[model samples]
Target chain A: MSELAIQTKDISMSYGDHVALDQLTLNIEYGEVFGFLGHNGAGKTTTVNILTTLLKPTHGKAWVCGFDVVSDSLNARRQIGYVPENVHLYEAMTAQENLRFLGQLSGVEDLQKTIDETLELLDCKDLANRRVGTFSKGQRQRIGLAQAILHRPKVLFLDEPASGLDPMGMKMLRDLIVKLNAELKMTIFMNTHLIGEVAKTCTSIGVLNQGKLVHKDTLKNVMDRFGDDETLERLYLSLNTQKVA
Target chain B: MFASRYIMTAALRANLRDQTVLLIAGLFIVLVLISAYLGWSATATVQDVYLKVVEAYAAKGQIAPPNPVPDTPPLGLLRNMATYVALIGALAGLVLGNKTVSGDRKSGVYALLASRPITSSGIALGKILAIIIAITGLLGVAALTNVITFMILPNFSLSADEWFRLAQFYIASDLYVISFGLLGAFFAITSRSEAKSLMIPVTIWLTVTFIIPQLTANVLPMAALNPLKAMAPAPSGAFFVFTQSVLTPISFAEAYRALAATLLDFAPPGFKFQSFISPMLTLMIVNGLLISAVVVAFGKMDASRSAYDD
Candidate 1:
């Protein structure tokens, strides 16, 4: 078993009577692109929030990069980069300025160089000087990706990273995720419902339904169990329906 | 250190971007100008009243007038302007301070800033510094305007002592306003909505600056038992009787009498004390307590909690 970059043991979160995440246990290995597949309100964002140290778990424990998510949050935050579902950037600021601000907060040394490289990596060098408010959704998503990877974090928690992007933009993001995983050897923990993107990018996948991880396996294992004849979407539906029965 | 500087810069930028701040500054300038004009007029009225009273006494052929004629000069106009300018400075401080924290919450900028690595105290202090800079800039302009207006006025002559007194009053009044305004900001930061935050400060200002002072002036028996009167108690041969009559919860009245006796050149014997404390000491202590309370409340607030959440 490779070293686990993220480990959660029976972690649970509740907002009053609503259970956002219920005793969810997950382990993601280093350098693996793990796709978290779930419908809306399936606790994917909540799990990502907990792993990124944006939120505290109501119960159980979570660790990222060998530091407790709650007790050693500063270390955990330093180790992981987070891209929220919506690419919320300061609209008034230029792409370069936005990246610089986030980079500084992340304690990135050689901030200017990092911003340049990240912008170039996202193929957004031309738009760097333009205000982000003028950018398209795809451009904003790219900028969001650049900010997330600027600090060279060990793990990246991308909550719907391809959301609101056009087909071409989605393809570009898929390619970028693969490149990050293969070349950088960085763990990508992505939450998405786009099975096509998952099929292309992720090596391992987990299916979450109603705050429970119903399936966790490699693409090969999932294909073998459900057969290559059937699509992953159909297999996911059947599995979920079976659970309902 | 760099983070604090960055935060301060960001706060200043936000203030500049806010249209409401600009509007408030414009209104404050108008108020200052109007008040300055009114002050000039009021001082002219005082001069006319003095002249009339002197004329009335002259008709009686009294060689030595009971009251000296009040001087009407540019110096007096400047002094009047200074008083109105101080009030304007206080209003500016209050408006800026109340807006600093509450405005952030209303604009949703507080949440964005809180998501960063900065603490609540840092954010609060940065905002306070921004408002201070804004208020100081506005007051500087008003002061310059006052100086120019004084230079244009006829017979305007302000000695160094007069200028210093005006400056002293401005500093003290601005500090007092900022302190209370910060307290209001703290309240706004912890309140559910901006309306409540604004209301609390306005209510406190009305009570402390207007209502309480009026109540103290009218209800406080110290005025009737003037210290000057106590110094001349022997005119009625009732020194001991007057002292006993004035001895109750109105110790301040007696203290004022003692103070007058000490300051009066013709005060009788046996009324002097070796050591005397001024009432300004009590005011200083009260101001210190209010400021400390505001600082403590500001320090304890959590930047992460939304205004509606609180």
Candidate 2:
């Protein structure tokens, strides 16, 4: 097994003439809450897609938990779970029903028990029997999180996890992210434009602008060098501006 | 295989909850029942009129002509079922097929499914299997209705040979509708817009069910309702010959109706034994080809880009 939780080598993805992700290289250690900051269409989701084995990079390679995202995609997928921006599910089904379906697809053994434990772990056991369509955005996100981690994946990918959430919802998600990373020892890769959430939750941060990574460092080093969320925000803006220029 | 099993179960549950699909399928089964009732009633009505004429001949102390109702095949009463299956049953299958894929895409669950340890082909196969099972269930109801009607209604009992023919008719019907379902799923996977996903297959269904038959067999639109109606031979000409040669091979509606007419024992005189066998072959081949196309289209689909095209 690889020491790194996730690794990529000059992965490039293009749709026709437009490149969604350029030749980019990256790596993250196990158990790190790595925040990927990028403006809309900066290829954050695209990167997550590649890492989750939902996509194959046009040129180059990626590995998740030592498994190639392309050639060994099924094994790579077995290691990771992903929640997209909005986190839609079968609305007519209950939260538990949706979770069970996805968990079975993941080939989780002891499925019923795992579903119960995962729901309890996410602190949303009350929502399990309720229909997903009837739940609020916050409630749905909790179910989504439960579904993603049902198989106990080694890595979890979140794309705009905090989007459309109220403050309390955001806090709950942050707490869950922390719990999964700290207690479960799972590598967490988050894609978001919210630097505030990154500052609060991510241990390491990388800034991507137009498919290019401009800055990457540990949160402590970035905080000591750049000083606080306000200064870090400025640095983020400046990096994007420079990349655009 | 495990992933596909669960996927199929989930899809079946989701489809059952979809009101639109339920309504369409329910309507189809209802139509089949109604067609059977009407067939029984028509037989009774003709029998009543013939009895009245026979009594008048007996009162005059004259000979009565033979009863015409005996010539009508017991299964022929349900001939409207062929048309119903061709039109409404195919639509139900199409809608079910569309929902099978579009539901995942619209709900944004395609990414989740795709990211799982299952291959896209597995996902496609699971969904296709679900369609096959659902269509079979629908046609099974229609077939049962025919059997029950035959048992209850007088002058409608079938011999063992006819019973086997009825079963074959439904199996062929199931395949015909399933072909449309696969067509719908193929378009749903390949097309971006939900409307296009549904519309393209419907257009093809219309072309196959109506236009092609007219061009090749010179079948009038109404004549198609009576699967046993003898096609009026078109004027012998180059255009007619050319169309018959080109379109006949692809005319599944004609194939299906020919097969149904033969099975129901209502075929026109001089219906060849070869015609009976060829339609079934055509249906099986078309289904095989459609299944292959659908699996290939799904395997090539980009999962990351699979989102609702509103």
Candidate 3:
């Protein structure tokens, strides 16, 4: 109902003495493919965790689909789906079984029909009955995407879903993300350190450096300012350099 | 509360498909049958020996050798299954439960499962329900096989009282078996590694099964159902009596063996259901607490945090 599908204000997270995310604030409109860019330990996943209502923020507030991340977490969870990094799911079970389990949790109706449709949509219909244990990494990613989209979430959160995939797998995932956003009218929040993937897939980008968001803007606007893809890298390095300075 | 059917069924399917569960369950069946066969053959041998001696006396030998003590109540002849329940049945349950959380970790599904709309308590309950089904199904089959074997063996038909006692014995066995399962699950979900979690339950199982038997007085083969064997030392001082009274309730294996013995009519020294009720209650309470602990542990876990202790 809100103009933004995801929103956060001055959220900070700490584990004992160390802070993983700090005063991070951002918002994404209903249909943007927002790419979260940061190196390891840059708080990208932490931010994704907060917005997905998985972790409560130590300071500030977050809202997913107009539900408070802490207070209205269940409703927030219902409105979003997550695919974590290195997500190997129910290897002993077939893809259909995995879908049934997660589908029921999401309260989907007619799970079997929906699963068929999802697999068809993702071009994984043939692999539906195969045990996930036998699946290649790329095939598992397809299943992951299928499950996340099974309930038709308003916002899908992906944590480095492209990290370890083969080149073809990455391309298929890219096309799938684009298709889900365009055809399903869904919003996407993708966490990645891979800027090239962002250039190819994400429309909006935010770069986090050392637990803080150092820069954020529309890709086109960023390209105009920096002049090219190579300068985008230069800009990112300069931002991290400024933080360390 | 979301429907746990999906999760519960998945877990049960995994349990059913697991080779270790199958192997342990198979071994339990074999041992139970072997124990029954041994009891039946031993009873037959005693009867045959007595008859032969009696026939010799009639042919002009001295009076037949005094008859060996006959096994009484007929139900006592069937108690080998009880001991199996205490050991193998418990291990079967233990093996099923210890893998629940660890299974998720190994399959890389905990993060995925935790992210769903369901509460962690719901997830924990689903897992517990699956274990309950797996263990019950396993032990139920073992019980059924024993009953069938008893019917087939000559001179081993069950009377009404024997049937009731047999049922009671199994209830006790099921309770004992489930407790170990819960204990193993507790460690699996709480600990950081498989080897560490595994060692805890097995160590306790070994301690309860073997070491404690050595330490107790009735330490004999058939009479030490209550392993404390503390009665003899009690005459020495009030301290021994007090200690026995305190420690008896904590010995689950002893409690189960004692309970099963009384129900089966072995009635080890001064055996009465009333005396063992406290220990049975302890077993029941411990099981309830373990199931609740699993639910609470999962509920309190920080799902938002990436990765498990594993």
Candidate 4:
């Protein structure tokens, strides 16, 4: 297997004249929780979409766990799980039902047992039998997390996972992400604008400005260098300002 | 294959829970039952009246007119079923097919599906299989209802040949209904707006069901609903001849009616069908094209932008 869980080379995506992702290259090692920080329309979702094999980049190449996303999408998909910004499962189905379908698609051998174990691990076992339409955003997020980790994919992609969560919800999600990474050894790529959540959850951080990567480093290293005089938010802003100039 | 099966199951479960789909299917089944009951009631009433007239003629020592009731084929009693299937059943199919794709698209589940190990073709196959199963199940219920109605009605026994003909009638109806389902699904995959996806196929359905028949077959608006009248020879005119030549091959609704009427053994007096192959072939071709269109649309669809515009 390739050492990198995710890799991209000069990957650019253009929609007509507007470039969603410019000639950007990135790499993330296996088992690292990488936070991708970008403002709205900074091509964060586009990047996650490309890595997850939901959309192919217009130019350049990407791979997930040694499989090219475009040429070997199925194999690449087999190694990854994704939860979009707004997780929309079949509303009429119960939480377990939704998980069962997605798990089966992932080729889970002992599906029922896996579902039970995953739900218990997420601490939302009580939400299993209830219809997803009735759940709040936080409850749905738990179920969404359950689906992504059901197959124990080597890499998990979360696009704006903290967008609609309350403080407790955010904490629960952060804890779950950390648990999944530490326990399952899964590589996580999370895209968000919330620097605070990044401080709490992500081990490494990359800042994207105007579809360009402005800064990339481990959280500890970044904090060591820029933490004393300026907050991470100010540091993030300064990086974007420099990129804009 | 396994992924397709899972998708099929998920789609079926979601469709079953959908109120709009449920209502349309329920209405269709109920119409089938009612059609059977009404056909039986009409046949019984006509027979009773005919018997009474025969008795009066016997008392007067004059021969009664030949029995008109026996001249009607046993299967002909359910001829109205063809119209119901053509209209209401087709509508049911459209809704079912639309919901299969649009539901996922609208709910943003397509993103999740696209990220799975399954290919787009697998997803399409699963959804198409679901439509096939659902439409077949509905038609099966209608067929069983017809059989039960025959068993309960007095003097309405079906022969082996009649039973086979009844089955043939439904098979033809199935093809006609499934085509509409595929058309709806085709639009759902290609059209950006959900309303356009549904409305476009509905407009096509309306055109084929009513307008095309009137132009090409010289069938009146209401006569289009009756299988026997729908097959009457078109009136002689250059315009009619041109339309008939141009539209007949593509007029699946007319073909279905003619094909269904033949199976049910309904025909106007002294009007002989030149051949059954023409109508049968038309339906087969039309269905084949629609299926291909659906497969192609699904294969080429961009999953990232599949969500509706409106």
Candidate 5:
């Protein structure tokens, strides 16, 4: 297996004249909880799209689990799962039904068994028969995570997963992300602008500015240099302001 | 490739579980049963009247007219069954199509679907297979309803040819229904927003089912149920040519209507399907092309970004 779970080489994406991701090179190793931070339209979702093989980058190459996203897209697709923001899945379907449908699509063997185990692991075994439409945002987010990891994918991509969550919801999500990383040894690529959530959940972080990646570092290394999460926030804000100036 | 089967199975379950589809199907079955009962009641009335006439003739010691009025077409008992399938069945089909692949698209589930090992074409094919299964199941109910009516009617009996023709009518009905389904799927996938997608198919449905039929029935007042009337060559005129050329193609529903009229043996005496083959083939080809277009559209889709499903 390649040491890296995700690798991008000078990747850029442009929509007409609007540049989304600018010649970005990035590397994330297996089992790393990667928090990709950016303002709106700063290419966080775009990067997630490219990594998940949902969109192809215009100017460069990307690989997931050593499979080129464009060329070996099917193989790369097999190695990953994605949960987009506010993805209220098949609202009419029960939790088990939705997971069964997705798990089968993901080609998980023994799907019913997998669904039972996955729901249990996500702490929602009792809610399995309830319709997703009835669940709160935090409960739905947990179900969303369950679906993403149903196939035991090598890497999982979540785009602004905590966007609509309350404080308790956010804390629950952080704990869930940590549990997934520890128990499954799964690499997680989360896109978020919340510095607190990032400091709590992500092991490594990358900050992007105006479509360009401006900073990349391990959370431990950054905290050692900056002293604390608040100092890191100040550093992030100052960098954005400097770019603006 | 294996995922294709799973997708197909899931799609079938999802389609079957859909409440709207089930409701439409239930309504269709009730309508079919009512139609069958009406046919049965008519059969009893006709038999009772015949027995009275025979008894009267025997008492008077007069010669009977030697006329046995046979219900010429076997399945003619449920003649309105065709229209029901075309109208109600097409609605069911449209519902099925809109909710299958496009449901996932609107709900943002296709992003996860795209992340799976299945190819886009595979997923589309799976849904297509599900549509076929759903349509077939519906048509089977229609056929069974009519067939049971045939077995129970006292004086009515089905000839071998009539049996074959009844089956043929259903096959054509399946084609007619699926064309609308393809239309529904196409619009569902390509429309800019979920709310707007339904309008395109509904407009087409209204035009094809009610509007076009009414127009054609006005032009050829008995076009739907009457046997084709043999006529001389058209006069050299613009209106005649447009009616014969432009309007006929757009009124593809008439193709099924005419074909059903012939199979039910209600065609004007001496009318052969040879004259109607062109229209039927045209409808089939047009339907085939539309389904292929939807498949190609799916092939080119950016699975990551949905077209505003909700």
Candidate 6:
């Protein structure tokens, strides 16, 4: 009964002669952890980039929080927080400074408190004063998350948030994502290749292959379609092979 | 309000943290010191040479040396130092501005910043302001050193008026350099590589500052002619008639005629249209045009495009 947080109608994008997104239509409801699965060049980043207003869509339209992504970009940008794949920070600045800088840019009032709360929420309060260049991969990931959620965005777009994290780090990030969705009532749109992570955390899922959405359903629905005998990993492999053939 | 302030603070901090910035500032200080010492030594040598020449002329009784053989330094040394300072300032601006605009793209910071709510114009403005502040600080230190050198030199009384005039010239020169620097930054943002951006500014600076000045001074004979000549009254009497008969406009014969007319009590020339305001106004207009072009180019820059690729 909740309204859709994101809606796209036959969206397509191309770069030069190459098609990046092929008439992909999708709808994600409010407060759902929507996992977007794709291979290396499966238009995942491209879709996110268009949704986040970093790139203009070549065709069709996308609506984020009831505002068109292209025509109402300022509203869409104000409504969503994006964490790019690479956790690049101002290496010269400390974690706290980076959070504060991003928080202000996101129009978060009481910037110092927001930075502190975000850092504390990520359990990075102790590392707040440390320069990002000195932090480990997991620490940088945590800081990146802190920056993304600093403004308490209605929807969070995370691109491979746990890409290079250790097992423990991955668990920690997964727990944080679940907590953010449940406690904050935020919609999560994540792009990743970690089927295990997606299976464990996602409430709804969409699989992209060769610039097209091949599968999309709730976790239970996807599991039912594949049956109990087949694992999600097996289903993914079989689907990818089908695409290749 | 707070967001803009935060962005500016971050930009200033980033610029200050850059090792290349520190290196450039250190290099500037070293160059200023070297220039000061060389200028001082050269001025002393010129005074010594003048003293020797005067003493030799007096010894030969060829001409009586003027009172006390005044040890006035040749004005050229001071003027040359000012010119060097301006040149170095331009070079510093080119390097710093190029890095400020293109370095972010090269380092992957541009994409990150662009995805945020920060506009391209805001980023460009913050960067340009930071560079201007840094360059102004460096120029201030150089000017202070120049003033101190003049004060310390023996028998070199640099009056307040002269100091003001020198400062005015330096400020004008700095303005010109900053304008070119902004142009360089714009080019760097648009160019495929930092080297191309840097080369364009340096080439333009060299052509305008060195080549143009040389050509204006030496090659253009019409530029040298006084505009007040048409306003001067015709000469009278036998002296003028005789000079007019002997002289022609094409040769130094005209110069001899003028001297003879002036020596034989011809009236002084009338008021001329010559004024420093015209050249100064032209320079200001040129600076405005360059700065506006740079700003417009910066405003149109697309952050998503790769700065390293054409």
Interface RMSD of each: 3.9, 0.7, 1.5, 0.8, 1.5, 1.9
Instruction: List runs of model 5 lying over 4 Å from the truth.
Output: A224-230, A243-245, B209-236, B246-251, B272-280, B307-310
Better model by DockQ: candidate 1 vs candidate 6: 6
Cα lDDT of model 2 by residue, A1-245, tens digit: 89999999999999999998988889899989999999999999999989988788999999999999999999999999888888889999999899989999999999999999998899899998899999999998988888889989999999999999999999999999999998888899999999889989999988888888877788888788765655777877886777532
lDDT, candidate 4, B114-158, per-residue tens:
888999889988998999888999999999999998897767788
Estimate how well candidate 6 is docked, as a DockQ score. 0.44
Question: Better model by lDDT, 1 or 6?
Answer: 6
Q: CA lDDT of each candidate?
A: 0.65, 0.87, 0.79, 0.88, 0.79, 0.70
Per-residue lDDT value at A180 in model 5: 88
Clash-forming residue pairs, model 4: none
Task: Encode model 3's per-residue lDDT on B1-310: one tens digit a residue.
Answer: 4557777888888876778777887898788878777877877887787788899897995787666634456777766676678778888778888875667755667777777787778888888888887777777877786687677665567889889888878788888888888887888777766787788998988777665543342233333333233223223455544545655556667677767777777655674432345656877988899999999988776665424445
Clashing pairs in 5: B227-B268
Where does the lowest 10-residue lDDT sum fall in candidate 1 chain B?
B218-227
Judge candidate 3 against the unseen true structure and give its global Cα lDDT, from 0 to 1: 0.79
Off by over 4 Å in 6: A238-245, B1-4, B38-77, B151-161, B192-310
Candidate 6 CAPRI grade: acceptable
- Higher-scoring candidate on TM-score, 4 or 5: 4
Ranking by lDDT: 4, 2, 5, 3, 6, 1
Most accurate candidate by DockQ = 2
**Per model, how many backbone clashes are there?**
4, 0, 0, 0, 1, 0
Itemize residue pairs with steric clashes in candidate 2.
Answer: none
RMSD of 4: 2.1
| lDDT (Cα, tens digit) per residue for candidate 5, span B68-183 | 54634556555677667767877888877777766777767777778888888887777777777777888888789888888888767787888988988888888888887777
RMSD of each candidate relative to the true structure: 8.2, 2.3, 3.2, 2.1, 3.0, 9.6
Q: Docking quality tier of candidate 1?
A: incorrect
DockQ of 5: 0.74
Stretches of candidate 3 off by over 4 Å are A228-230, A243-245, B46-71, B211-239, B272-277, B304-310
